[model samples]
Target: MRSYLFVPGDRPERFGKALAAGADVVILDLEDAVAAPNKAQARDNVRRAVDDGAQVMLRINGAGSQDFIDDLALLHGLPLRGVMLPKAESVGPLGELAEVTDAPVIPLIESALGLWEVMTVARGPGVERLAFGSIDFQVDLGCDGSDEALLHARSRIVLASRVAGLQAPVDGVSVALDDEAVIAAESRRSRALGFAGKLCIHPRQVAVVNAAFSPTREELEWAARVVAACERSAGAAVSVDGAMVDLPVLLRAQNLLAMAG
Candidate 1:
């Protein structure tokens, strides 16, 4: 999935719109997006969304929050694809969360301690992906929210996801709703840095995000050529084009094909 779009948990009205917007996954956010007074209602709303076949994901509050347990209870026995566990500080929380449900959990590492324990968290069972929580991450670092401030965190999440054989980490949401140019630039940068997908706040931004992440026609052609050459070479590591096509290159070609699809 190259684009994961978010809808506020309390706004069930927007869920269908988000699904129609073409995001591969739709996350009903119960964390920062939900007001405290609406937390209970949001859980019930998310449960209904999950049952609606929207490639459902629930972003629950922190592992230790009062809302987290209630969120898990509502999530249990539902036909959920996954849960996005925000503020994941340790494998212990992930372990505890998994015991309560069977859905795959995507850990959102948003704190300094979470970054410190990322590899451990990624290696935990039921972790299908690791997402960078940029807003809270900036708070954790006490740094201005900018590309420079987030490079290290993005790299760490990608590295941890790779180490655990999980899907490449999703890039954080771009808050500039009016700036398509800026959002496209950020998406390109994330793609260059090896992120497989991006999280989006607005449905209007979903197409742009998906376009930026998807392999271009030129890229797909090149990848197909390389793959065909490898096959013609009898699976040799070197291609007829004088390029070395090893496992990494092969994997990249495969991913290009996947994305092109």
Candidate 2:
């Protein structure tokens, strides 16, 4: 899954549009996007979507909040791709997650404490992956949202995900709805930082994010060549494109091929 697209839960009409937008995973958002007064209505919309078999992922509110409790109550029998837990700060809330539903939980690390305890949270019950809520993380830290400023947090989340044997972390949204170049650039930056996927807000950003994460033709060709050379080298030193094709490089090539497939 390279692109995770969010649709407001209250906007049930947009669910089909979002699904058709070609995102790897479409998320019904019950937090941040919906107003407090609309929470119940949003929950109803989500329930209806799932009841109709949408097969979408869901972004629930923080654990322990009334909305989170209600969200789980409504999610009891829904077949979803997964559940995203926002503002994840501890394992205490995540302990009961496995008991509530069998859906995989994705912890959104958006705070200093959450980042600090990322490994533990990644290892929490039902945690299948990690996501970086960069906007909220910056707000919590009172720091600039530049790539440089958020680099450390992104790196930590990626590392924690790898250590916990989860898929690579998902990067936050670009917020630039109209600019394709900027959105693609941000997604590329996330990929450079070891993120496997990007969280997208607009449907227009899906193709761009997916392109940024998916291996390009050139990359696939290079990996194929490297792999071919490695097959003949038989553990000996080899060179590909003027650079030494060492064990690590060969492994990276193989990983790229697997990702492409």
Best-performing candidate as measured by lDDT:
2
* Candidate with maximal TM-score: 2
lDDT of 2 at 35: 93
Residues 113-230, candidate 2: write the lDDT tens digits: 9999999899998999999999999999999999889989999999989999998889999989989999989988889989999999999999999999999999999999999998
Stretch of 10 with least lDDT, candidate 1: 235-244
How close to the true structure is residue 229 of candidate 2, measured as C-alpha lDDT?
Answer: 91
Question: Which regions in candidate 2 have their CA more than 4 angstroms from the true location?
Answer: none
Error of 2 at 77 (Å): 1.6
- What is the alpha-carbon lDDT for the whole of candidate 1? 0.86
How accurate locally, in lDDT, is each candidate? 0.86, 0.92
TM-score for every candidate vs. truth? 0.93, 0.97
